[model samples]
Target: MRCVLIISKMQEMSNVLLIIQASLMGVSLTLFFALVLSSLQKTDTTKSYEIVRWLLAFAMLLFAVHYIMQMVFGFRAQGDDVGAVINILFYSPIAYILSYSILRIGCGNNYYRKFRIMSITGTVLISCTFVGGYLYYGSMHMKGALYIMGLLYFFSIVLFIIYPMKEIRRIRKMVDEESGQEPVLFNMYMRTCTKLLWISALCIAFSIFYTPLLVIIGPFFFIALVFYIVCFLALGYNIRQMSNIIVAETEDEVNADGVEAGTVAVKVVMSEERKEMTKALIEGWIKNQGYASSEINSTLLATRLNIPKRQLVQYLREVEGKTFRIWLSDLRLEEAKRLIIEHPEYSTETVAESCGFSRSLLQVKFKEATGFTTNEWRDNHARKS
Candidate 1:
């Protein structure tokens, strides 16, 4: 009977250990994933915005490493000491700094220095309280330390929440001014992150109830890690959706074969009639004008065709898959080559002039368009004949 009781007790202990180990493993995995996604989010266009997010991810990674080491090494913080110290040192400062950067970016570039100083002051003040709490109540029970840490964290998290919201709103306003329309996806993603920040902050405050475990290893950290991972995935989805929409629009414009009224007519691949009309128009214009230098310019071509600028651009891109200037230069240079080879009596300068280019311009454009100088092109053609 005594042996059986001892075996049962040992089994119970083993089970408990297994549960704790599993939880720690889960948290570590979550932390690593958060770090990767957060790194991607660091690509914000503004340097100030990118820096704050980078610091937040860096601090969180450090906190994760500390937790993993403690879990594996059989370490426990006496009372709620660990939670208080980490909350002050890593959590509060990261939150405050990130918030301040958002606010500064929203307000304007000019306000960044002032907000940075304010964020630093907040970090210092909070760090002092955290250190003081630990030093003064080092020997106190877990409950006493928990109460002190909880109060300090509440204030810090509030500051963090308020600043980011104000800054995000400011960003929205600026975006609205520039684009002259509210960007739905951009605002939605920012709002989602801000909302997550609020929820994660609340989770931290709630985790104070589990102060003993929190001091050993906090659920707040794990929860924050998960929240950030979700935020990044959500943001990535929105960006991809926007990208897809832009690509679809471009493809649709290309597939439209005919001139969408007020545009230079586009040649349809299957419609020989429209293709013939387009070729005739281009040829007739070239033949009558005696090859002026202005024919190579897209803006000049669009004006001569009585077409809208955007339509002309789309027509050239879709039908030829080349820009107006490139297509025009190829045609002009090819004609110049034929003239040089067939009419040997024509001088190189005269051939260049007749093709609507100065002697130097002809040589440069010819070499750039084809991989050869005019003289080289002449020799290659003569050798072929």
Candidate 2:
């Protein structure tokens, strides 16, 4: 009876929840491993692709190492407090990656250097707390230290998640301002990774209770489930979604101008002469009334100018802190005024149509530009003429 009791006391595969949780973790590892390998096989040919690869590796490293430790130690880790310090260690870098790497996927150049500073500092603080907590909780058996450590770690994770979001909004603003290439797919997939990161953060927070088992049954393998979904989607992106994010830069070129609009830009990489060339092309395009087409956008205009759209966009932005659409509006407004002054007999619809402005749009834009309604401006100009 004593021997049987000893055997029964051992941590065994007796719990159905544990088995199912472990199986899900195994599935998570498989999918995550596949994601890492896919990132490797896809080649680091694009900035966005490379950033995605780094994010995958960051998550995989944490998940893989923690999972291995959990499997080997099982419930024993929980008993001995083996997981107290290391869980924070693993979480620190994963939070860093979640905070910065995914955001860098499209807007690497726009990434703030200060994000590096803040995340690194957060990592260091988490480390300090882990060390302090382990000594007090593990060495002194003061359980309060463990709670303090978990609380601090949870706050840090939340900070990391929220910090870079505003900059992401700026990225979309840049897109809407400078390029006609709608970032519809980029926004969607980006939202996907963001939601996953949030879920990962929450999972890590809850796992403070069972740190050693986090990668296994911790939080019921929620992180693993997230990984499964991401890898599944990532597989699709690797195959085709990559191109879908942000409309194709150009019809005839693979990221023509060596820039991905609203994402990868070649501003600093471009030379002065190259910039001047783009400027000249745009000035010539505008001089020829290319802005007179309501359907005209930066991408189409760049193609018509026979120059790279990215180059054209950068120039337009510098032309007065104006976006591509705004600049187009200004140009069209100018044309609308000229038509009114030169041909007063032309009706509002005629002038609006000639200048690529819908009649109502012309009225609105003209009012904004000259503080006068289109008809009002026309009457004033016609009276003076």
Best by lDDT: 2
The TM-scores of all predictions, comma-separated, are 0.44, 0.55
Q: Top model by TM-score, which number? A: 2
**Candidate 2: where are CA atoms >4 Å away?**
1-17, 75-86, 110-112, 136-142, 210-323, 326-385
Q: Tell me how candidate 1 scores on lDDT.
A: 0.55
By summed lDDT, the worst window of 10 consecutive residues in model 1 runs over: 240-249
Residue lDDT tens for model 2, 100-131: 65556544444646677777876787677667
lDDT against the true structure, per candidate, is 0.55, 0.62
Error of 1 at 99 (Å): 3.1
Worst 10 residues of 2 by lDDT: 242-251
Prediction 2 TM-score vs. true? 0.55
lDDT per residue (tens digit) for residues 114-142 in model 1: 44665676667666665566577674334
Error of 1 at 366 (Å): 50
lDDT for predicted candidate 2 compared with the true structure: 0.62
